[model samples]
Target: MAETNATILIPDISGFTEFMTTTELSHSSRAIHMLIDAMLNAIGEEYEVSEIEGDAVLLIKKGPAPSKKEILGICLKIFNAFHSQRMWMQQYTICPCGACKAIINLTLKFIVHYGPLVELKVGRFVKQSGMEMIVAHRLLKNSIDSHEYLLMSEKLLKQVNDSTETADMVWGNAFEEYASIGKVGYHFALLNEARKNVPAPQAPQSYYRKDSTPYLQTTIAANFLDVYMVIMNIPGRAEWMPGLQKVEQDMPDICIGSLHHCLFENHQSTISPLLMISSDEEINYAESCRIEEMNISLVYEFVFKKVDEKSCHFSVRFMNAAELPIPEETRGILLENMQRMAEKLKLFCEK
Candidate 1:
């Protein structure tokens, strides 16, 4: 056994237990792997990956502890990358698999600690065994009381003496007990709260229609074609539209008379007749879906306009076929959903 001083960090996907139990095993497993890959990518060169424990990753750095600046940056990079991947998955993933679509429900959390570790090689795997490793893993179960948060052991904090940069970014708990590391003290940081503390990227500019009609328009800072590709992919609405499990077009080539159908999660369905309004000229399309049972139809319009050299204005317009008046509250909900979809799409391409 080789003894070494090391810092252990476990960034786990919280709530994965309930997620795996409820979602289809195949899809859930694939989504978990993808998310795991994303987290590993976020870690990059600074930390070493010792092992993966289900939804949690075991990262160890064999040396002196990282400064507050290093730890803070690493945590934020993981946090930001987690959401960035989720946002991209939510916006453009066309899998239609239940678990793939439900990724937005999962959140990432971290447990960081520093101590002496004994390294033992078990075949091809390098296992870390020591009191600190036990303490780091035990720190995973805590009274942090928040789903999206990072917990750091007092041991690690003591190693990073100068953290004037991140001094205001954390709060502490004086003591907690562990079987191996008794009376352990630590600090917890809500990742969302950390985001507010850090300087964030600028959000897109939005302008919703002031009229009672439900519509949302936003200028996203990306090439118009990047945004247009996402809007025009009809079969890919599985990403942005909730409750839609799968979409299929009967004809191989979508012409003026192509028929398409959408199967929703609630067992309700919609059959739409595609209109070849502007297939390739510019990103604009209109289609109508019928809810036969309700004796009503929804008209969906997608339009994209170039705003400038770097940005474009994209809008989603929905209206009832019978020209029925929409309830104020219902309109608000629709507008909110549309805006969220736009924002997700923006994040997907912009990032």
Candidate 2:
């Protein structure tokens, strides 16, 4: 068995707990999965995904180790990507559940170690195992007071010290005790500077005008959050929405750029959510799509108001994005379909 040198990197999420009710638990799981995917997609081709271990993603690189500057650069990229996605989730969410609102509190940290490992092939899977692998995993449980930082093993630090790119870098020391390895020391750097460089996510574009009126309006006998959740349930739209045969979501979580194809009775349209705004008094969401058959672009706006604990007011408006005149017959057909769908939506939410 040949010993191969490898560098192990793990990006672990913090503030995730299993203490929640059914509703919170479900939303929390989806939110975490979305964040993890965001980090994975931001990684470069130099690293290979070894495994996804719950809240942490294990990545491995073969042969030569990455320099300290390169590792820090990658860490910064991961933090920026994670925070950008987190901001998007907080801003675009219409759900008021505890799990959805708590996404802002979630944090991410990294663990990096460079050492030798023996690869064991099981059927088709390649598993990297050795003492260095254990040390990398153990460093995840160090005495770092803050939740967000980068921890590098002392061996990796020594290898990095041989390079000349080390300047203006501040590091702290931390140690973790292992039953078999006695005590292992590592260097840590807080990610506050990296996080500060990430710009806030831009707000979604709005297509509403002051004179615009809702094409269809209805009041539902349910809470505002309940109505919002029911509408955001893209898969369940076929049940209450008229003429919608099915919905194919392009991504697991719905954000501003998410696209989903809707199969209707006669035609299909690609819908993308453009805006989602929620406040104490009301919640507003908007979706835009091009009606190729009519050669017109349309924006669908949903406004929900909390009238009381048991009931709320919901209205749907259609905006012409192209600012072109719409035929009376075409407008009439749209209103008729919306009216029927509104009735079914109320029934579904209230029941």
Candidate 3:
């Protein structure tokens, strides 16, 4: 209703244009989508995503200004999530595709500005715009001289007091000019160095069946039992699952207590074993444990609902998704793989 204080943040993917042109179209889309999804997950539910403009996401947080520790904490979460996701991507999904392989070259940076802002609901869409928002967006195209950085407006720095400053909090001031706004001063915080020892996110929460929680659900056009059977056959999943080079069942019969080992993408690395917990005609449960960068324990749940004789609703969810950093992409990659598996299964079952 009235102008209120807000923080506008833009996390942009650097060198995306080149990534798109050089990598395979599908792979480029998947890789970029994964990275962006990871960033969005890192940002969490704290801020509102006003819009996604190309390779950048515009985030706006409106309310009383958060304290220096709070704002810095939020920034560190985003930075750690970004870094963890990137490194995890390289370690897992060891594919040779240009897009999959190109993550090593990708980098992320954020431009944040805090000031007053007003919002208007334009028809079905909520439009957020203000002088401060423009400043945040314009700051993205700056000569910061660094790719992995967090640029904060001087207005924000004023709120960060001396006690809150840590040894790694090295910031340098700069200025820029724009029409209407004139010259605006800002500071650059080296995101990587600033987040030297932030605690990584671990310990996945209990499987949230709520609408707000992160999950993937879809219906597949295939026989219900047939779909169930396909997923139940864990070893055969490598054919449809992405980055899966091999799946060997350590315990035969595929029942409760069955252990399935995995070799990812190539023979270079191995994933945690899949311990079957529940197995039924229309439902299945399993757990995957591994220590890559950090300990990872992912609980897998699958449900098959019959739509009719020829088609059915097949949904899979990954919960207890923790023990490592940035569980966002773990869920993301699993969801993506599930979608593809459903498609391939539909194609196969219909035949």
Q: Among these predicted structures, which one has the highest TM-score?
A: 2
Itemize residue pairs with steric clashes in candidate 2: none
lDDT by residue (tens digit), candidate 1, 86-204: 66555444333457567979988888899899989989988999888888888777877788887888789888875677766666575577664677788886777764443343332
Per-residue CA lDDT of candidate 2, range 283-346, in tens?
8888887667767677788888999998999998777777777788987877787788789999
lDDT of 2: 0.82
Residue 217 displacement (Å), model 1: 33
Error of 3 at 326 (Å): 41
Question: Worst 10-residue stretch by lDDT in candidate 2?
Answer: 161-170
Off by over 4 Å in 3: 159-162, 194-351
Least accurate 10 contiguous residues by lDDT in model 1: 202-211
TM-score for each predicted model, relative to the true structure = 0.57, 0.83, 0.55
Candidate 1 similarity to native, TM-score:
0.57
Candidate 2, residue 229: the lDDT equals 82
- Model 3 pairs whose backbones collide: 204-322, 295-323
Top lDDT prediction, candidate number: 2
Candidates in order have lDDT scores of 0.71, 0.82, 0.66
Model 1: colliding residue pairs: none
